[model samples]
Target chain A: MLVSYQTLRARPADAQRQAIRLGEYQSHTAGLGKGCLQANVVITPAAYALDFMRFCQRNPKPCPLIGVSDTGNPDMFTLGADIDIRTDIPAYNIYRYGELADTVPDIRAIWNDDLVAFALGCSFTFEHALLEAGIDVWHISNNSTVPMYRTSIFTVPAGPFRGGSVVSMRMIPSERVDEAVAISSRFPLAHGSPVHIGDPAAIDIADLSRPDWGDPVPMPVTHTPVFWACGVTPQAIIRNAKLPICITHKPGTMLLTEVPDDADVPLFQKS
Target chain B: MLVSYQTLRARPADAQRQAIRLGEYQSHTAGLGKGCLQANVVITPAAYALDFMRFCQRNPKPCPLIGVSDTGNPDMFTLGADIDIRTDIPAYNIYRYGELADTVPDIRAIWNDDLVAFALGCSFTFEHALLEAGIDVWHISNNSTVPMYRTSIFTVPAGPFRGGSVVSMRMIPSERVDEAVAISSRFPLAHGSPVHIGDPAAIDIADLSRPDWGDPVPMPVTHTPVFWACGVTPQAIIRNAKLPICITHKPGTMLLTEVPDDADVPLFQKS
Candidate 1:
C-alpha cells in the first residue's frame, strides 16, 4: 500500500499510518504526515553535543532546531509524543569517519547510551506553505530532491563543527518573489526566507544543475531559482568533522513529528 | 576634553574614545560613535557563564549577544581593534550575591582570573535608525531611559538563569509604526523590532510610569507604546541566578565597540 504526499499530509501522525510506514512501508517522506511537522534527524555522540548545539545556534538559518533529545534517550517526546527514535523513521544513513557506511531501516540495535538525537526543521513545512500560496516548489513539481548547493558563505565555527552553508534551491516566478519571501518568513522553523533570489554563482554554486547532494531539479522557463538555507548543514558539518560514528536519515526519509501544523514555533520560542 | 557624539562617530576607533570615557569623561553614548555599535555590559564569573550564554541564546530578542570576553582577559578585540573591557565603560555596577554593592568608574584592581564579560546589543542603534527615518522616539524626546517593563513573558530556563522578559518601550504613531518596524528589523543584533505594541498589560506590565528600572516616559495620545526586547534581561537573569559575585555597567553606561553600524551580525545571517 503506497501513500502519496497529499494522503500523508492530510493524516500525519496516524500511528497506524506511521506504523504502516515502518512495517516494510519504505518510501520518501516528501509529503507524508500532512499538517504534522517532519524533521531531519541527526544522531551523534554526546562528545560533540555542545559544539554541535553551538553550531546550530550560530547558523540558525540553515539549521533551525526543532527538538534536541537528552543524551542516550531515544524518546523524542518533545518533538513527537510517542516517537521511538530507534524505529520511527523509515530509513537511516550511517556514516563512519565521514564515509557512508550503510543504509538501515531501524537503528534499534545501533542506538547507544551516549548518542544524542537532534530533530531539525526541514524545508517540507515551508514548501507546503509555498504551494498553498500558489508558489511552485521546483523539486516537488518534478518529483525530485530539491537541488542543494554548497555556498561560499562561511558559518561561525564551534568546537569541531565548522563548514560553509548548504542551500536548497526553489524556483519562484518573478512577480511572486516578494510573496514567496513573505510567506516563507512566517515559517522560520522551515529554512525561513530565501537566502538568495537571483544569482546562483553569487553564492558560490558554480553550476545550477550540478548539486553537491540530492537530485537537481532544474527551474522552469518563467521562474527564478531562489536559494534557501537547507537542513543538510548539520550533516555536512558532521561529515567534515569526521566523527567516529554518526547517523542521519537518508535524504527525503524524514522523521514525522507530532507537532501540529499550526504549532506555535516562533523564531526563538520553545515550540 | 569632551567629545561630541557626531565627532566621536567620525573617529575610526571607538575603543580609543571609550578608553577616554574611562578617564572621567561621562556622557551619553547616543551619536557618539555614529557608525560604531554600542552594547550593554554584564560581567560575571565563569560559574555562571554557560547558563548565561544559554539564557541569551534562548531569549535572543532582548539579549542579542555581540561579544564575550575570554575569562579575565578584558580584551574584546573581536568587537574592536583595542577594546579594554575593564576600563572601557564610563561607569560600572558591582553586585554582591544579587544586591547592588557599589558603583565605580573602573574595576582594574578587583578584576580576577575567573571573570567573563558579555557585551549585548542595546536598543540605541535601532532607536537611532527610527529617529532618522522621521519616527519619533518618545523617550528620547522626553530625555528618559526608554521606559522598560518587567513583562509576564517567561524566558526559557537555562540552569540557574530564569526570569521574566524586560522590554524597553517606545511610542510609535500608528501611521509610522510599520516604517519603524522595518527600520528596526534590520538591526536584530540590536534587539530587532518591538515584541509587543499597543497595550502594556497584555504582557503583564502594570504601570506606564514607575518602571522597574530606567525612566518612564509617557506615550502620546494617539501613539502606540511599542516594546522591544531589552539588554537588561541578562542583568536580571544574573541577579536572580544569585551568583556569589557579578558586575555590570550602570543602566545607561555601556561598552562602545568598533563594530560598524552596518557590520553584519552572524545571528541574523540566513546562510
Candidate 2:
C-alpha cells in the first residue's frame, strides 16, 4: 500500500532514512520529504577516490560535493546519523567498465572496505526554491523530466575524468527570469544559477525539441529557456573513464539527509 | 632605491607587476597597488600538486583558491594577462624538504617545468573593504601586524595535509561587531566573515598579546576581538607535509593581481 504525501513527505530525515533502510520505499525521491535535501550518491573504489574528489573540486558547478564518507567507512556521520552508504539510497545503478551492469535495491553482497561514497547536492533543492518563489517550472507542471543537454562548455578535467558540461533546462516566463536567477543563485549546492540564458547556441544547444537526455518540453511563447549545471555530468564522465566499479543513484532515487538545505553554500559546515 | 607608497599606490596592476618583475620592488606588498587583490602564493612540484589542491579544497575558509596555474606553466593567465609566476611576486620563500631554505627576490633560477603555483586570496582585500566602510583597522592604525592564532578547529584533511586552523584577529567596537561581520562576509575570497567573535577563549586564544605568527597590535579596551580564517593554515599544513620542495610568499610579502577586491567573491574571475 502507498502512503499520502503528508504522511511520507515531511518526515524528519532520520525516519525517512529508516524507511529506505528497511526497504519500505524504493522509488524516485522527488516528493518524499518536502524541504529536506536529497543527495545524489556516487560510490567508487579507493584507488580512484582522490581523482574523483579532484574532479569535483575542479568543476564545482556540476559536482557540488556536500558530504564525503571516510574511506572504507559506510557511514557519513557528518551528513546524518545511522546513514549507511550501501543501503540508504532508494535504488542503485551499478556501472561496471562504463556499462550499466546491474540495478539493485541494496549492495550488501558487493559491499567492501575499499569503497568511498560521495553525497553531492541535487537540483531538487533549487527547484523547490524556485517553486517557493512562485516561478513556474515547465517540466514539473507538464509531468515530465527536465530536459538535459550536452554543452560546449568543457569542464576542468582531473586525471581520467574529462568531459563537456551537461545542463538541465526549464522555461520560465520572460518577466520571471530575474526571480529565477535570484532564487536559484541562493542554492550553489543545487548548481547555483543558470550557466547560460536566452540563447541556445551560446552553449551549443541547437535544438530545443531534441534533448540529449530527459523529456523534451514545449517552450511556451512567453517563456525563455534557462539552463543549470546538471549533476549527471560526473556520472557520464565516470562512465567514460571506464572505472572498474562505479555506483550512482538511479536518476531520481536520491538519499535523504538531516542536513538542512543551506542556500548558496555548496559545502556547509557547522561553525 | 626604495620607492614611496605614494609612487606605487593605486597604480594599475600591469605597472605594479612590471615594477616587481624588473627587480625594483622587493618588500612587503601591504600598501602596493591599493584596490587590487593580493594573493598568498604557493608553488610546488607536480608530484604533490594534486594533494595540495585537495587540501585547499577541503580547507577553503582558510585557503580560498583565487587562481591555479596550469601544470608546469609559469603563466597564471587566469589571474592576470602578463603574469610570470616565476618573477612577478616581490619575493618568494623557498622551502626544501619542508625547511625554509631561503627568501629570494625572485624564483627565476629555480623555476622548473614541473612547478605549479596556487594563488590564494589574502585578507588585505577585506581590510581595504573595512577601511572603505569607515571601520578603523587596529593593526594598520598602529603600524603593526595583525595577531594570528592557531585555533582548536580542525581543518578537513586531504591526503597528508592536516593541521589546526589559524585565524587573524581584529578588535571592533562592541557596537560595530554586527557591522563588522556584515561587511567582512562580502569578501569570501578574503577570509570572509568572523569565524569566531566576542570571546578569545571561544576559539582557544588565551591572550591577545601573543600570536603564532605576525606581530601583535594592542587590543583596545572598548573593542571586542573578531577573527577570520587565515591563509597561513594551508602554509602550515604544506610545511608539515615534508614535501621535497615548496615555495610560498614570505609572511607579509604577497602577489598582487589585477582582480578587484570584490566584497563577497574573493575568487574574482577574469583578468
Q: What is the TM-score of each predicted model, taking all chains together?
A: 0.76, 0.84
Q: Which candidate tops DockQ?
A: 2
- Candidate 2 chain A lDDT trough over 10 residues, lowest sum: A262-271
The C-alpha RMSD in Å for every predicted model, in order, reads 5.1, 3.7
Please provide, for model 2 over A34-118, each residue's C-alpha lDDT reduced to its tens digit, 9 standing for 90 to 100.
5656788888887777668767756667877777776677876656646788888878989998898998888888889888888
lDDT of 2 at B266: 32
DockQ per candidate, 2 decimals: 0.16, 0.24
Q: What is the C-alpha lDDT of each candidate?
A: 0.74, 0.76
Global CA lDDT computed for model 2: 0.76
Residues A167-270 of candidate 1 have per-residue lDDT tens digits of: 88877898888998898787666777877888888888899888887787756778888888888877787778999999988877788877765554322223
- CAPRI-style docking class of model 1 based on DockQ: incorrect
